[model samples]
Target: MQPLSSVQYQFPLQSLNTFGIAAHAHAYLRVTNTEQLIGVYADAHWRALPRLVLGGGSNVLLTGDFSGLVLHLALEGKQVVGGNETHHFVRAAAGENWHAFVQWTLAQGLGGLENLSLIPGTVGASPIQNIGAYGLEIKDVLHCVTVFDPRDGITRTMNAAACGFAYRDSVFKREAGRDLVILDVTFALPRSWQPNLRYAELAQAVAEQGYAVPTAQQVADTVIAIRRRKLPDPAVIGNAGSFFKNPVVSRAQCAALLERFPALVHHAQPDGSEKLAAGWLIDQCGWKGRNLGAAGVYPKQALVLVNNGGATGAEVVALAQAIQADVMAKYGVALEAEPVFV
Candidate 1:
């Protein structure tokens, strides 16, 4: 195997991410297949190399130029397995664009991924954080993930039960970060999926239009429209959709906060904790549309931290820290950043 020292890197990741934070990786690996991945990790130069796996670069903020190889997953493959119209099985490569895949599935009349339309990131990274939007999460439709485990250098398959998916979190985001390199993801999307009209925004939009049973395409379109209105196009503006995950707190804390504010916005979770809307808290604290240095909170989305023009990663991180501190000081809620920072 050739040394990774000769491997190429397209440096200065300024425009790769939604938030165009200027950062650079000393080494870059674009692994297009399982064999390439093995070669990448086996290379002596890359073996001890500090590395970062980059996909579409949608949900991350690089604080500075990495001094190691940045492995970019560019693998792409998609297919259908078994099952009739009622249920369908599909597999997608990690490098596949997430929004494009959702659109393609909708074109195929697939219903499961419609509600999560327009989310950014790659197929491989989707299971990393279990990306969720609208009223659906990736875990709802996920069957298994094909991962290249670094522990013993073997490929392993994991199901949802082993993924440890929670609200915007999974094992990949926790202690499993560098342990696995997601190869492909398989999902069991149902054709006869009934519309989930639970989220208030979606419900209101449907009721206002007086639609009783909306089709999967309609759901995809609606969700896309809503997201478009809230999130700035990464091509137009630099941002990582939501800067922080919604904070889930103990029921007791929710009760205490609701009693104090009387109109505190909170979602009841099946778990014992109450999900606090991070946006609402940020908005309440007047972080919405607030700008500091080159970083700013998106005007329409208080939860999103935006790069007005050429914000440094450190600048964005500082703003996030300020917002976190403010929310914690005011509401006793700690805001956790969504982007995976190395």
Candidate 2:
């Protein structure tokens, strides 16, 4: 096996993760190209160790130092892979910054990704969470994803249907995807664009701004403006955006909750389930702006859990547990965290 490139030992991770958790990987490797990835796999030393693929670090929390190999996918590039008169197909490397890629698509006059504007993390991480915002999710635009299988040391593409997408989840988040590493993703965007104004806040903003027929750019800008107001910038504060998944309940459960709190924020899913606003539940339980040790719920958005400087991962986990228990006890709804705790 050839010597692998960009390898390091005992890498500091505070700057890498958005939460600013001070943790270290036993060993780290940044694979810039497919060849480097292949070489790493060819080495028995690396092949035998457990591996974790890290992208932009926006959607993960470090519970403690990682004991195995951490592969930082630095591969980067994008291109118009294919297209039709009605749609355009574009492919982007896994390491591409998600927000920048969205902006780039907008610059190219592509329409599908606008609703997902300003989301943190990388293209690789998007599919795993089926990341969504302002009424649009990644599953809507994703055409296919390219993956590298460590077991076989081969690359392959899986179409959208094979992704097994659900709310904030996909096969990549489940057992089926453990052996696969995301390499790049292709998106199918409509050329004949229609802005998604299904989200209430975005719709109100666009209406108040007097955009009767909003263009793709206008919609993107509006969503960005709304997110800026509600979600804290990770750069200014240590946080993973939206710490909890909005719990989905049955219609009967929704009716029961409505009996007690008529003004509860919720949306009816097509499958007859109702999705509750996690932030609202947390706030109603009086956890907003509250802290357990060094971790605190963000005062502006109750869904976010923040590191109030020098906080440990255990503290964050404990704070999340407290919030979960309170919400469960009060509303009988379990608030599952969005970020993956490593």
lDDT of 2 at 209: 93
lDDT for each residue of candidate 1 in 280-319, tens digit (9 for 90 to 100): 9999999999998999999898998888988888889889
- Judging by lDDT against the true structure, name the best candidate: 2
How does residue 342 of candidate 2 score in lDDT?
A: 91
Task: Give the alpha-carbon lDDT of every model.
Answer: 0.84, 0.90
Tell me the TM-score of each prediction against the true structure. 0.95, 0.97
By TM-score, who's the top model here?
2
Model 1 weakest 10-residue run by lDDT: 1-10
Clashing pairs in model 1, backbone N/Cα/C closer than 3 A: 18-239, 19-239, 24-65, 27-69, 27-70, 94-124
Q: Which TM-score value belongs to model 1?
A: 0.95
Query: Compared with the true structure, what per-residue lDDT tens digits does model 2 show for residues 1-342?
Result: 654657888998888888888999988988778877788787998888777788988888999999878889888998888888888999999999999999998898888899999999999899999999988998999999999987789999999999999999999989888668899999999988898888888899999999999989999899889889988888988999999999999999999999999999999989999999999999999999998888899999999999888888899999999989999999999989998899
